[model samples]
Target: MAKKTARIKTDTHAVRLQTRDDVETAIKQIGDLQRQLEGLAIEQNNELAAITEKFAPKITALKAEIEPVQQAVQAWCESRRDELTQNGKTKTGSFNTGEVQWRQRPPSVGIRGVDSVLESLRTLGLTRFIRVKEEPNKEAMLNEPEIAGTVAGVTIKTGIEDFVIMPFEQEV
Candidate 1:
């Protein structure tokens, strides 16, 4: 019988910037470095996704098995919360586990029939009590010269306007 052997290996290399004596050359080198890093990041993410895909079925099965137990535990906690608090116990019995306590929250409301309600409020002169929110149309603002000039100052500015780096091959 033969025994299998395990081995560890590494490939290390030094990288130095090769460029002409100018700011533009250095900038180009920096842009190339950024693109290389981005490519490596994408490759690593794809590898991780493949590993996750391999384990997904097992993970889903485990979750399905534990779901009923989780629901039972949740019900038990909710039912016993008042009794536990009354007995001056803010947490569960010490089994090297964390505490669980009930929390108080404000009730939430959902509005329906918004148009009818708005019309009623306007008819009853109760418009002041009703809140109105208005936002500038971004497409119209950008397309119209007058509107664009007016709203450009207050609009959220994004992206590089003057300077941008893109992958480009050197001319022969």
Candidate 2:
């Protein structure tokens, strides 16, 4: 006579169900680690602030002493640069110690009274130079799927989510 034994199936679902307690324990550990990290970061910032405060006065004084000498050197360099324009280059010039160059950027135009400009544009109904800008309303977008689909260059992604300790809660 032979005895038959039933064997259990090994699958991911079975394994997950068996290890549910382990998963919960890992999540708790991660939460504790995050709390510890936040506390350490705050403590480190406070210590750094104290050290910076102790040295700030000396640093300021050193910078103040160097300013006049630096300004004199810069003035002399500018004079030399004007004289050494023989190479037909306006941006770059080399002096005794090092090379000096001017880096120019494209000019940008800024409007000061934006509300008045908008009002004028709206009154005149100008569409070429200026037009009313329509920003996406978040609540409206969430309620309307058709509008969300029509919008371009928008991306949806899954982000890492974690539990945060509430400030009002007592320490466990």
Candidate 3:
């Protein structure tokens, strides 16, 4: 096997606006390009909508044909599940065309009226079921930066800056 060579890229032609006139021209060009991009996106979406509208009726008909057949197959399989799965020894039944499986979803807990439930649990001495989460308080740390900064793993970051350019456009 031949060794693959890595292709490195370098920025040789970077934009450098020297004067106010050049900056103003660049902003005008950015606004024009943005308008062109928005026009192209609208055209592409119109074409996609036309294509979807053309095929939507056929898709609806196909789905209507499939639902009854799927229901029939599922009912037949469910009625003969004991024989198909060999008396619950397996979860899947293999046939010439494909295999069908019976799956049990994992159990989940649902809660409603959280405040009342918590109060009842506390009154009944069932605190073990109630969870208490303990984590670092970042807001408190921000309030007391002097004390928080003294910690070994924590560092206070400052003076972050970003450069942004917005080209103004007039609505017609």
Candidate 4:
């Protein structure tokens, strides 16, 4: 006679358990997602910084451009005030204007800037002096060949130098 071996079957009510490999894989996937997110954040920050850096110079340059124009206006105003006092002294030998018309030709360029030069040359204070007339005098000094260069046309005044330009057509 042969001996029979006992057999047993496991029950379905036992708890399921996870392996170490599964836990490690989940942790690694989370770490990878966090690293990707951090990289994206850094890239976005760099792009923003580059854009701001590019515009900074243009903004500064624009401000620089306007400074010279402002300076020109300031110089013009200071010159006008000084001219008023000196011209008054020369004409009346004193500052007494109780009965004078203050409305006489408001300082060359709007009652402001470089009065002495304008007075000396009998011109209104302006960046350029151009004849507003449509036609030039045919027999005037502008037509003369000798001294025409001196009084021919508009005078351009920059801080560096003064320029005299003549043109067939007047600038309106």
For this target, which candidate reaches the highest TM-score against the unseen true structure? 3
Model 4 spans > 4 angstroms off: 1-19, 66-172
Cα displacement (Å) at residue 128, model 4: 65
Model 1 scores what on Cα lDDT? 0.65
The per-residue C-alpha lDDT of model 4 at residue 166 equals: 20
Clashing pairs in 3: none
Per-residue CA lDDT of candidate 1, range 20-99, in tens?
Answer: 45546765676567656767999999999999999999999999999998788778777876675666556442224655
Per-residue alpha-carbon lDDT of model 2 for 1-172, expressed as tens digits? 3322222233223234347687666556655666677679999999999999999999999999999988887788677766665554677777778766667799997898988977787789874657547886777666776657576965433344543322221255
Better of 2 and 3 by TM-score: 3
What lDDT score is found at residue 59 in candidate 1? 99
> Residues 83-172, candidate 3, lDDT per residue (tens digit)?
999999999988999988999999998999999999999999999989999998999998998999999999877555444555676353
Clashes of each: 0, 0, 0, 5
Query: What tens digits encode model 4's per-residue C-alpha lDDT throughout 58-80?
Result: 99999999999867855654466
When 2 and 4 are scored with lDDT, the better candidate is 2
Model 3 stretches with alpha carbons more than 4 Å out: 1-15, 44-51, 112-125, 150-153
TM accuracy, model 3: 0.72
Per-model TM-score on C-alpha atoms: 0.43, 0.54, 0.72, 0.28
Best-matching candidate per lDDT: 3
Clashes of 3: 0
Angstrom error of the Cα, residue 104, model 4: value is 38
Q: Note the Cα lDDT for every prediction shown.
A: 0.65, 0.66, 0.83, 0.53
Query: What's model 4's lDDT at 102?
Result: 24
How big is the positional error of residue 91 in model 4, measured in Å on the Cα after superposition? 38
